[model samples]
Target: MILTVTLNAALDITYRVDALRPQTTHRVAGVAERPGGKGVNVARVLHALGEPVLATGLAGGATGARIRRLLAGGGVREAFVPIGGESRRTLVVAAGDDEPTGFWEPGPRVTADEWDAFLGRYRELLADAGVAVLSGSLPPGVPRDAYAVLVGLAADAGVATILDADGDPAYLGVRAGPDVVKPNARELSALHGIILGRSVTVGTVDGAVDAAAAIRALGARSVVASLGPDGLLAAAGERVYRAVPAEHVAGNPTGAGDAAVAGLARGARTGQPWPERLRDAVALSAAAVAAPVAGELSLEEYERQRAAVTVTELR
Candidate 1:
């Protein structure tokens, strides 16, 4: 079973507008609410794909309860530790003509006692987990090295861990050594102190292979870098591969990365080869981008796109 850990769980609210203009009023065309946080999003996608997943995280107050109910309704098994503080809410305003704008709350403050309680719950859950996914940001009062600690615990239990996060938590988690690390181009640049938008384009097979090798050398048993419409590039051990999407169907791009991580986790649990894993990741992410809601993908769309995913082994 796939075990997912979300440190700062949230209730995600998305609003779609024809266009966003500062200091102007606009009518919202649609809205959607979902239980969110990177790991939670990942678990939801896996559950939709018929994978057995256990989502563990910190939650509190009415919003937390709502999130739990929503996950249960979606057929995802969850084990969350309730705290005294209220969980956070995130707002995504998608402009019909442009990229979505995000407003995020830092989340509630967690106490030392609450942290300890969460650790205890994690230990119990990790005992039977096959693959562990540590994702999202740390709450205000939680330690920055939270994912690092969980990485150590999962490793001790002989479970491969996949980390999808950013900033210090991601840097610290890498030091703890996870089996796989999925980061988008911006996050990758931030981790390595490279400039954002300064990506090395791979128009040729050899260039893609070289870039994949370079990414793997930075640390990580495997690296999957999502390159927007260019598709995804993956490097595992000495083998490198690139999977291109069948078409570019634009919608809300908010949860594409989380969906990709879910696909990768599902593939890992099912013993799918690296090539298939890349294909699934690309297809799922593409499907997510085609959906109007954040962190949700159309399963039928994913299945249709899955068959058209073109993967080339560059190594």
Candidate 2:
């Protein structure tokens, strides 16, 4: 089974308006909500793919309850440890064809006892897990190196791990030697102290690969730098590969990275080659872009895009 850990899970809410004006109110045209946060989003994609997956995390209060309620019917088994603090809610407002504006709330603070409880449960789940996915930000009061701890535990349990995170958690987690680390261009730039953005150019792709190499030197067995529409750049050992989509896709790009993570984790668990894994990840990411919401992807698009993806060895 694939085990996904979302320490900072949330209820993702999207609101649609005719147009968003700074100082004015507009009537809501539509609303959509889903269980979210990086790992949870990954789990959703895996479950949709008919994979045996388990989502484990810390959740509490009304928001947490709702997140679990949504997950229960989503055909994904969840084992969330109850906490005293409320979870978080992420709001995104879509206005016409313009880019969506998002508001992310800091998740509730987790107590020390709650953290310990989660660790215990995590250890048990790792026993049955083939690949353990540690993703998202650390909630307030949780250790900054929380991902590292989880990675170490997974390693001890003989389970491969894929880490998706940013900032110190990511930096520290790399040193613990996860099987693979998937970071978007922005997150990779943050770790390497370089500037990377959504509009990834050829030069930026080179920069991202360089950053991935540096990150790999820190102990990650492999580093996959997600370059948005530019696709993925992966560096493992002395080999480097690039995977690019045949065409640029535009839609809600919110959970594209999570979909990519699902593909990567699935590949790791199934022992696919690096090039194949990158191709799968890139195709899944594009499929996610065609979907209206995060965690949902057009399978037809995924199938068509998979064949269209070009994977080449860089070195």
For each candidate, give its TM-score against the true structure. Answer: 0.88, 0.94
lDDT tens digits by residue: candidate 2, 240-298: 99999999998878889999999999999999988898899999999999886666998
| Residue ranges of candidate 2 with Cα displaced over 4 Å | 22-26, 194-203
lDDT at position 248, candidate 2: 92
Candidate 1: segments with Cα more than 4 A from true spot: 16-31, 94-101, 194-219
Provide backbone clash counts, one per model: 0, 0
List lDDT for all candidates, in order. Answer: 0.84, 0.90
Candidate 1: worst-modelled 10 consecutive residues by lDDT: 193-202
lDDT of 1 by residue, 175-245 (tens): 78788888777666656543123544444545544544544554567878777887888888677788999
Which has the greatest TM-score?
Answer: 2
Model 1 TM-score, all chains together: 0.88
